[model samples]
Target chain A: MIAENVAFGIIAAAMALGALGVVRTKNVVHAALYLVVVLAGGAAQFILLGQEFVAWVQVLVYIGAVIVLFLFGIMLTRAPMHPKDSLDNDLRWPAAVTALFLVGILVGLLVHTFHADKIHLNGPVRTADITNDIFTTYIIPFEVVGVLLLGALIGAVVLARKD
Target chain B: MLLNEFLILAAFLFCTGVYGVLARKHAVLVLMSVELMLAGVNINFVAFGAFHNDRIGQVFALFVLTIAAAEVGIGLAIVLLIYRNLHSADLDDVDTMKG
Candidate 1:
C-alpha cells in the first residue's frame, strides 16, 4: 500500500511537471520532448492501476508513434529552435483564466463525486481477457477502428505527398 | 490512491492542454495540445475501469488510443499541407480563407 502510494505520487508529479513544460516551453521541439515525459508518466499511471497491457500499449503507441509523428511534423514545418515570441498569441491571459476555470470545475466535481472511493489494485485484467472481450462484445467498434486507421493512412499520404 | 486523486491529476493535464490549444500560435503545437487532452481522458477511463473492476473502460481506452493515432497522422499531414502552402505553421498566418 505504501509503495503504491509513493509510486502514484511520483508519477503524478512527473506528469504535472511534464505537462507544464509542454505548454510553458517556448521551443517547439522542447515541448515535444516534454510531451514524451508526460505520456510516459501516463503509462506509469496505468501500470500503477494494475493495467499492464494498457500501460505498454500507451507507451508503444504514444511515445513510439505519436511523438515521432509530432517530431516529423515539427521538422517538416521548420519550427524554430530558439525561443520565439510568436509561439503564443495575445490571448495568453484569457486562455490561462479559462484553463484555471476548467481545472477548478473538473477537480471540484471529481472530489465531490468520488472523494471517498478507493480503487483496488488486485484482480488485474489480463491481456487475453481484454482481447477476448474486444473480439466478442466490442467487435464492431474494433473493426471500425481498423477502418479508421486505414482511412487515416490513405488520407495522410494523399495530403502529404508531393505532386 | 484515491479515485479523486487520479481524477484531479487528469483534470490538471486537461486544463494545461486547453491552455496550450488556446494560447499557442503554431498549428503543430495545437495538435500536440489535443494529444495531451486525449491523454488526460485516457487516464480518466483507466481510473474508472479500475475502480469498477470492469474491463470495458480499458477497452474504450484502447479505442481512444487508436483514434488518437489516426488523428495525429491526418492532423500532421494537414499541418504539412498548410506549411507548404503558407510557408508558415502559425495559425494566424493561415488566414487567406478569411474574408
Candidate 2:
C-alpha cells in the first residue's frame, strides 16, 4: 500500500508538471513534447490502477499516433520553433483564475463525496472481458465510433485537399 | 490507494487544459489542450471502472480515445485550412465571422 501510494505520487507529480508545461511553455514544439510526458504519465497511472490494456492503448494511440499528428500539424503550420510572445493573449490571468476556480470546486466536491473510498487495484480487468463487453453490451456505440472514424477520415481529407 | 487522489489529479489536469484552451492564441495549441482535457476524463473513466470492478469504464475510455483521435484528425484539417487561407495558425486572427 505504501509503495502504491509513493508510485502514484511520483507519477501524478510528473503528470501535473507536464500539464503545466504544456500550457505555460512558449515554444510550441516544446509544448508537444511536454504533452508526451503527461500522456506517458497517464499510461503509468492506468497501469497503477491495474488497467494494462488501457495503458498500452494510451501509449500506442496517444504517444505514438496523436503526438505524431501534432508534430505534423506543427510542421505544416510552420509555427515558430523559437519562443515567442504571441503564444498567449490578454486573457492569461483570467484563464488562470477560471481554471483555479474550477479546480477548487472539483477538488472540494470530490473530497467531500469520496473521501473515504478506496480502490482495491487487486487485479487487472481481463482484456477478454473488455472485448466481450464491447461486442455485447456496447455493440452499438462501438459501431457508431467506427462510422465516426470513417466520417472523420473522409472529412479531414476533403477539408485539407486543395481546391 | 484512495479514490480521491485519482479524481483530484484528473480534475487538476482538466482545469489546466481549460486554462490552455482559454489562454492559448494558437489553434493547434488549443486543440492540444482539448486533448489534455480528454485525457483527464479518460483517467476518471479508468479509475472509476477499476473502483467498481466493471469493464465498462475501460470500454468507455476506449471510445473516448477513438473519438479524440477522430477529433484531432478533423480539427487539424480545419486548422490547416485556416492556416492556408490566413497564413497564420493563431486563433485571434481568424475572426472573419465577426459581424
The candidate scoring highest on TM-score is: 2
Error of 1 at A65 (Å): 0.6
Angstrom error of the Cα, residue A78, model 1: value is 0.7
Instruction: Kindly list the per-residue Cα lDDT of model 1 for residues A27-142, writing each as its tens digit.
Output: 99999999999999999999889888989999999999999999999999999989556689998999999999999998888888887998977766899999999999999999
* lDDT (tens digit, per residue) of candidate 2 on B1-99: 999999999999999999999999999899999999999999999999999988878999999999999999999999999999999999999899999
- The complex in candidate 2 yields a DockQ of 0.92
| Each candidate's fnat | 0.88, 0.89
Model 1 Cα lDDT, one tens digit per residue, B3-77: 888889999999999999999999999999999999999999999999999999899999999999999999999
Q: What is the Cα-based lDDT of residue A7 in candidate 1? A: 89
Candidate 2 lDDT, A51-134, residue by residue in tens: 988899999999999999999999999998874556998999999999999999999999999998999876877888888888
User: What global local distance difference test value does model 2 have?
Assistant: 0.95
**Deviation in angstroms for B45 in model 1?**
0.4
The CAPRI quality class of candidate 2 comes to: high
Q: Give TM-scores for every candidate, taking all chains together and pairing residue i with residue i.
A: 0.98, 0.98
Off by over 4 Å in 1: none
